[model samples]
Target chain A: MKKRCWRILAVVFWLLLWQTAAMAVNQRILLVSPLETLQALFSLLQTAAFYQSVAGSLLRILAGFFAGLVLGVGLAALAKIYMPLREMLFPVMSAVKATPVASFVILALIWIPSKNLSIFMAFLMVLPLIYSNFLEGLNRADAQLLEMAKVFRMSAFNRIRGIYWPAAFPYLLTAMRLSLGMCWKAGIAAEVIAQPKNSIGSALHRAKVFFSTPELFAWTLAIILLSVTLEKCMLHLVNRLGRGLENAR
Target chain B: MRVERLCKAFEGKPVLTDCSFSFPTGETTAVLGPSGRGKTTLVKLMLGLLRPDAGTIDPEGAKTFAAVFQEDRLMEHLSARKNLRLAVSTPDQQISEALTALGLPARDETPVSQYSGGMRRRVAIARAVLADADVLILDEPFKGLDPAAREVAANFILSHCPRAVRILVTHDGAEKSLMQVKNVLDLGMAKEA
Candidate 1:
């Protein structure tokens, strides 16, 4: 309870400082107070178009995240089983990790429709991170346990559930936590560039063009809230899955 | 099972050189040695977890092997019952019986990670015994157990694996008599080249 009080106090302090700064500037177009931002957000919440934008962005980004997750896990398994595949993937993964998100967005924009651009960007952002972390986790599995599995002649399915899953779970969770935030940020950036008709990014773009500083701040706040909420939900789900795997007989 | 002229080395330092022994079926063969005597190397070779620099381990038609390794290699996140189920397709009744015989709580949901050292060791042993393999390898299987628990574990193993070619790897000479091991291969006396 003490910690909660301190946190609330700290947020209020920051908001007051921002309000004072906005008043000093005396220019609403350049800087909006926290109150104005919240008011703008409340107005956005009242609109059907705002809901559509939120839904559209959420669906595309989450779709990309799930797709990246599945592919990353599958590819990591394949790489673990086959050495040549790991060798083949190493350079490609390195390149993907090194490449700029904007370069990909610009290149992808030419090939795909604006509505699909964020999906591709989000997937691209998430894939390498999940792949590397999961592969590292698999590589870190206990050698002694693996030998025990071999001696027992455990089936592949049993080996994965009993041995591999436990080893890789923490790394996968870390990947998910990291990639969730990145995917959202990259997805929004792609949407901003691609100008998808009904997306939070396009809404943000519109707010900026019309000199609606409060609306811009409101949209930015919404993105942060959504990112944090989604990340927490995903991590909780992953932890539950880990528990299920552990309890599986 | 038979090992003929088995040799193994690590980093060019010889651990076992031209060692041979026959492990009789339906009986326990104890491999006795101090640390660094290649007792584990021999066990690994027989289980095909390691390659002998030179060797031919004849299983004598045995297809399946189970082991309680030096480390209790239980999936740490899983309960004792789940660990057993991973290797053995045996029913819950048999699993519970095995756990009970080994002095572990048969229906406990606690993961082996939270168990005491001796409890984890028993889980590893139970997993091996329940596997019902053609060859059962027990590598210091009772390391962490008290004398009474050790006796119970030994008896459980002996009774369950009656038909298996059992190989007991231990430096402790008392284990040979405890497990009723008739054939003894003392690697301490063998020359390491």
Candidate 2:
């Protein structure tokens, strides 16, 4: 705990130096002091608009993430069962993976409303990763166990539960970890470009437009806090789910 | 029952050609053969897990079959008892009795992964035997155990279902004698290298 505190203190010390440098430069357009950023953050926290913006972005992004997870897993399952389906999915997954997030956001803007654009962008960012990882996992399931199940004439359900699920879980978990982060980053970027009403991105955009550097920094800090907290919560949920499965066994 | 004109090929290469045999009822038969000589294939064909390019498998009334694979194909997460229960709906008492006889002391709660190799082998054997089936196919069942453990397993098999049709596949001639195999189907002595 002491070592961790020291490391944190070192980070604070660097931020203080940055604050001093920004003040000495006296250029609010270029850089904002840590004190000003903190003051802006505290001031923003007192307003209902801040909460509304945070909540709006959170709901939309999470919606997209959930949708992607479901669709990706379903497609992966289909891809595993049918060769033609897998072949068909290959090019589509590649397209999604290869395309730039900004390109996707821009293209999506013409098709979807600005309010929903971030959600769609987040879905596009997450889908291919989940699908590819799950497909690879299903493909790499233990052949020996499968053969054994075959010899025993295990039911389809039993084979899936006993063999396929176990093999695919680790890969699925890894994909979830990676995809969640991507979704957040991409979703926020999409929101910033789309400038959706009642969103953190919109507030950030407003701050930038007004040259309120401290407000910008405050909102940026809020984004970082949300990202870190959400990632930790997701990891905790995944670990808890794993433990529950272990206990069920 | 008979396996008549049994022939199988992988890709372009043929493994068993025009192979014929009769597996007698109410008797234990050992299919003794060297590795890669279609012994496992023969077991699979009998179980209908594999198809023969040209052959007929005339199975008797024993449509239901239970098998101990060459590898102990067990659910790593589930306990020995749970694994057995999944395959067969036998009572806990019966499973316990069988497991104890096979020298698995802590039977019910320990997952197969936690068990040692010998213990896992015993669980697999117990699972196969406890399953309500007329035919039992064991593929190299006693590969990893010491002599004493093998004896215990053999005794458990003998006591559990004395009248079932047993097909034991192994490369060891000594295993044939140890299991008191009535008939030996030496696939090695059959035609083709």
Candidate 3:
């Protein structure tokens, strides 16, 4: 507890130094003080548009993440069982991995509306990472345990729950953590370029155009907060899943 | 059970060449040999886990299988009972009795990872015996058990599986005696070896 307090204090001290630097500069366009950013953030909180933007972006990005997760795991399982499927996906996986997120977003702009482009961008960023991680995990599964299961004639469901899940869990969790962060970053970047209405990205764009440094900092802080919160929640969920599996055994 | 004209080689080095044996049915036959004498490889052949270079493992009427490998092939996350349940459709009471007979009263709910070497061996034995298998293949099943614990665990096996064709592969000659086996196949002294 004391350590946590000291860490918090250290963060506060650094933040205060930032605030002092901004105040010494006395240039609102250049750097906004922490207090000014907080005030802007509080003001934005009162508007229904802020809430709607948060909800819309959160839902769309989360949808893409979940879709990618399902497809990635499913395809990986198939590929692990059949080498031909893995061979077929080689070029596609390489293309997805090599393509730039911004390029994909711009290219998608021609096919999709500005409102839904963030979802595609988030999905594109997340799918390959997850698929590759799951595939690696599957590849590295304990060969000895699989032999035991085979000799015992273990049912497919039991084999997955007992052998596959435990083996793949840590890798899957790491993949999920990486993909979640990427989705948020790429999703917001897409929104900024597309300039979707009522989004934090759009608000940040407007603030930049008008030189509202405090507003820009406030929107940035909001994104950071949302990202941190989402990460914490997902980690909590994965931990719970691990505990549930442990208890199940 | 018979394996005729069995021959296996790895990278041009023959391991078991022109080997043949008639394994007894509905009885325990302990195959004793030193390390690297194809004991484990033989078990793999019988179970079809590894394809023999040249041979057929004719089980005759065997359909299902249960094996305790040289390594304790346990799902570390699951309880012993769950592991047994995964193998067999045995009722809860039968599983409880089987575990108790093996001196594993608390094992039904305990994860196999927390078990000691002897306890894990017992669990592996219990799983193989209790599972729905026509034949039981035990590869160094008592590799880590102390003398007393081995006796108790062996007794559990001798009592539970009376009619199943049991093939015990081990380095211990004492283990063969404990199982009351009449035949001991020394793979190291096989004609081809």
Candidate 4:
């Protein structure tokens, strides 16, 4: 209760500071008060276009995130089973990690439609992190347990769910958290560059063009809220999966 | 089963050489050896985790397909039932019975990580006994248990895996008669070069 009260007070203090700054600027185009941004956000929420933009950006970004996750895990599994495969993937994964998201977004814009740029950018940014972390976890699996599995001739499916899944769960969760945050940030950056229809980045671009400072702030706030909510939802689901693996064969 | 002139070496240091042994089906063989006598290396060879440099291991009648290794290899964050569930396709009734005989928690929710050393050892024992295999290799499966508890675990293993070819690896020779293992192979006295 005390923490909650302090958080509320902190929010109020920031809003007051914003309102004072907006009043001193005396130009709605340059600075918008927190109250003005909040009002704009609520009003924008009533529009069909606003919902469409939010939904479209979310779907593309999430599609990219899931795609990257599947490919990363698949490649990591292959690498673990074959040393030559691991050596082959090292250079490519390192390049993906080293290259900036902007270069990929620009290159992707040239290759694909504007609507698909965010998806490609997001996947590129997340793949290396997922692959590396998951591989590290698999490498740390208990050798003795693996020997046990071998003696029993455990089927490949049971070996994964029974041994590898639990051993790799924590690493996978950490990767998910990191990749999820990166995916959203890169996805939005791609959107701003591509200016795709029905996207938060395009909406942000319009706000800047029309000198609607309050609308710009409102969109930024929406991005933060959506990013946080999605991250929390994903983490909860991963933890539930971990619990199931604890007892599952 | 026959180990004909089996030889194994790690990095030029010979652990075993020209060591021949035969284990018949439906009998027990107590492998008595001191530390560094390649008993574990021998077990690993049979499990196919290691290959003998020179020798033929003809697991003619019953290959050792199930084992309690030198280390308790139970998954730490799972309960006894959960651990056994992965290693065997045994029914719940038999699993519970095996755990009961070993004096372990049959269905407790506590993960093996939190259990004491003795408890974890018993869980590993239960998993090995319950595994659906013809040959059982027990390597210090009762290491952490007291004599009283060892008796319980030994009896359970003897009774449950009666039909399987049992190979017992322990420092205690008394366990031989306890499990009715009349055959003994002392690798400590075996030749190595």
Each model: TM-score of chain B? 0.96, 0.95, 0.93, 0.94
TM-score, every prediction: 0.97, 0.91, 0.95, 0.91
Best by DockQ: 1
DockQ category of candidate 2: acceptable
Residues B85-127 of candidate 3: C-alpha lDDT, one tens digit per residue: 8766788889988888878874457788998988888888888
Q: Evaluated on chain B only, what is the TM-score of candidate 1? A: 0.96
So what's the TM-score on candidate 4? Answer: 0.91
lDDT of 3: 0.84
**lDDT at position A212, candidate 2:** 87
lDDT of 1: 0.91
Question: Model 1, chain A: how large is the TM-score?
Answer: 0.96
- Candidate RMSDs in Å, in order, are 1.5, 2.7, 1.9, 2.7
Sort every candidate by lDDT, greatest first. 1, 4, 2, 3
Question: How well is each residue in B29-112 modelled by candidate 1, as lDDT tens digits?
Answer: 999888988888898898898888997889899999999899998888788898888888899999999888888899998988
Q: What does candidate 3's lDDT look like per residue over A1-249, in tens digits?
A: 999999999999999999999989999899999999999999989989889888888987888888888899999999999999999997898899899887898899999999888888888878888888989888887899898888777788778878888888888899999999999999999889998876767877888999888889998999999999999999899889877875663
Which pairs clash (backbone N, Cα, C closer than 3 Å) in model 4? none
lDDT of 2 by residue, A1-249 (tens): 999999999999999898889989898887889888889999999999999999999999999998998899899999999999999989999999999998898899999999999899889978999999988999888887787676567777667767787788889899999999999989888989999989998998899999988899999999999999998998899878865664553
Instruction: Please give the CA lDDT of all the candidate structures.
Output: 0.91, 0.86, 0.84, 0.86
Could you tell me the lDDT of residue B113 within candidate 1? 91
What's model 2's lDDT at A90?
95
User: Chain A TM-score for each candidate, in the given order?
Assistant: 0.96, 0.92, 0.93, 0.92
Ranking by DockQ: 1, 3, 4, 2
Top-lDDT candidate index:
1
lDDT of 4 by residue, A1-249 (tens): 999999999999988888999999978888888888899999999999999999999999999999999999889989999999999999999999999887788778789999899998888877898999899889888888888999977778777877788777789899999999999999998998898999998999998899888899999999999999999999999898788766554
Worst 10 residues of 3 chain B by lDDT: B101-110
